[model samples]
Target chain A: MMLKSKVSIVKGLSYQGGLPMLSWVLHRISGIGIILFVGMHVAASFFVHVVGTDSNIPDLLNVFYESWGFQLFIYFCAIFHALNGLRIIVLDLWPQALQYQREMTWLEWLIFIPIYGMGVFFILRNAFAGG
Target chain B: MSARSTLRPRSVQPAWSFEYIMWFFTRVSGLTMYLLALSGVVGAFILGARTQVDLQTLLRWMFFPNRFHVEPYLDDAAFWVTAWWQIMQILIVFFAVSHGFNGLRVVIEDYVGRSFWRPLLRSVVFLLWLAMLVIAVFVILQA
Candidate 1:
């Protein structure tokens, strides 16, 4: 059973979910992903680089780090998290921009695709070059 | 904590006074993170470019010498010589960590409801966040 209410304080807001809401959710997820990566990266670097922890663990992690596939996933998360963050900042700073949020989201995607594409291309080239 | 600042009505009032402030910070930090992350990601690739090794070769080299001999490459004097790079790295790391932890807090609050263990869980999460932040700072500076 579901209760109907005008106001609900779920996911930090009392509003109906929509495009902007979706953006917020994605932003949260991406931000958390980056944070998790930071933790993993730091721990791995510490043991391998500083303490010289002898184990195959760092090697296994390095495999993922050096993979083009993983790089692309990270790049995607980073690019969206950043540009969507910019959109959020604009909306917050200029209240009027709220009306144009849908447009802003579209514009964000427009900008993101090309940059992400170029990044992917660069990573791929580097991977295949065997340099 | 019970005196109302904005007058709409008690029934429709916010649950917590700090909610508004936290909401504002979430957005502000979002903006900061956007700038920091953009530069950091691009800067990382650019710095890597300087080394001129591709993915496969780099891996083989790293593992061949000593299996997974990964070390903090950022500690390279080349990176430290540039102050702006270090600053960017620090800011990016801090803002990203803060924003993410705060966000996770919000998620737990929303979903955990009025559970007896909420405070304990939240505290554990916060402590872990603090520890991670400290370790991250140490690792970055050591680099």
Candidate 2:
């Protein structure tokens, strides 16, 4: 059996925990996803730039970037990561605010939606505009 | 879930110094990532439009010198090489990678218990990070 740490974090696969916990998990998952993307991007650029090879690098990147699904996924990840990053900074700056972390999480979601919506709007507009 | 139990007490702290260092690093890196990402997004927006400055111009400056040897290319490349934005983007890549990987480390530590597999998993993660760092540095620096 796993030794339980004193922290009251929710465990188990159900992950039915509240928003803070959910935020924790999503933040981690999104962060990891972004890392994978970054790694791929760096590696691809390495070949195109460092090795000075064409090798369809531009084509691959354009295809990936132009795909709606990939774009939306990256959009979501970017929004969540950015907002969550601010929330973290706030909490860290005022540790007392940690008590209101749940409220902060809710506020983060509230802030994330419209900003994200605007971003998606532009992204979709650009996509459809064929520019 | 009262406030009292929420925090680890001063008495039973495990590896307090190490945790403090990691916590400090996270905050510092998180702030840096936020700034870099913001600038990067701004750079992207500037690139998307047909402005005086664009992403390809920055790329040609940062990465591609041999492929595009036109006058404008060299001129744009020269202007951008010293530009703060180009440097910010490069640093962003490095910080974003480190922040993401470190975030993964936190996740693994949180979810995976102190089992024999934990160390093994960490080693694998570390190796992956090392490989990424080497490639990332090469790509970022070797124009």
Candidate 3:
């Protein structure tokens, strides 16, 4: 039974926990996502600096980065990661706050949704407005 | 009882260890980036970025603060080319690159476990981090 359970866990088919587990998983995902974006962004800036702004590469990169789809994904990752990081930091500094983890997670979502929604709205507006 | 007294305290890793140092740095650098980005946003508005540049240009300026990013949009891009903005650009590049690459290292170490590839990958990441810093700083200085 133990071996079976371990295999299931390795396969990522286990129940694990719930919200807390999801939060931890999402945190890792978002962190990786942000790093990937940053790598591309920094490289683009460096390339533009070297080749000058007249090059088509900057325009191509800008088109990809400015798209509403990419913006939504990036903004979600960035906002979620930032807020969840603060939550983790609070828990680390004040261990007693562990008792309130569920509440904090809920609070995080409460805060994240509105900010992320606003960003999404603006991104869509810009894309539709042909800007 | 006071919150300090109620806090659980344990010492597993020494403060001088690489893991410990990086753990502390991750938090510090994350907070530092927030402050830097906040300043960037405030400074951008002060310089009339909202009216002068599009969303993309404003974002580019916010992230890098390089005059080249905003100069095409503004009639007077002189303010962005000043020493103060250059300093901000350098600081943002330094903190963002270091923090990001370190996070990648941590992720690799966590998932890769004990393997020959672990050290190899870590070295690769460190080299890339160094290269990125050099390129980013050079670009900022040149701009």
lDDT of 2 by residue, B1-143 (tens): 66845663454554668657767777888788666555555544444324554443443323222222223534354443434643664575556566666677767877788898788888887787778877765654565
Ranking of all predicted structures according to DockQ, beginning with the best and ending with the worst: 2, 3, 1
* Candidate 3 global Cα RMSD: 3.7
- Model 1 agreement with the true structure over A71-97: per-residue lDDT tens digits: 777777777887887787787676566
Scored against the true structure, residue B127 in model 1 reaches a CA lDDT of: 92
DockQ of candidate 2 against the true complex: 0.48
Candidate with top lDDT is 3
Off by over 4 Å in 2: A1-16, A52-62, B1-16, B37-77, B83-90
Error of 3 at B140 (Å): 0.6
Q: lDDT for model 1, please.
A: 0.65
For model 1, residues B1-143, the per-residue Cα lDDT tens digits are: 12232322334554566667778777877777555545644554565634644443343222111112222332343432355654655675566677777777877776676667678888977897787778766665665
TM-scores of chain A across candidates: 0.77, 0.78, 0.85
Ten contiguous residues minimizing lDDT sum, candidate 2 chain B: B61-70
* lDDT tens per residue, model 2, A49-95: 77767578755875785577676777688679878978988987777
Question: Worst lDDT window (10 residues) for model 3 chain A?
Answer: A1-10
lDDT of 3 by residue, B77-126 (tens): 98767889889988988888888888889877877777788889999999
Residue B29, candidate 1: how far off, in angstroms? 2.6
Clashes of 1: 2
TM-score order of candidates, best first? 3, 2, 1
Clashing pairs in 3: none
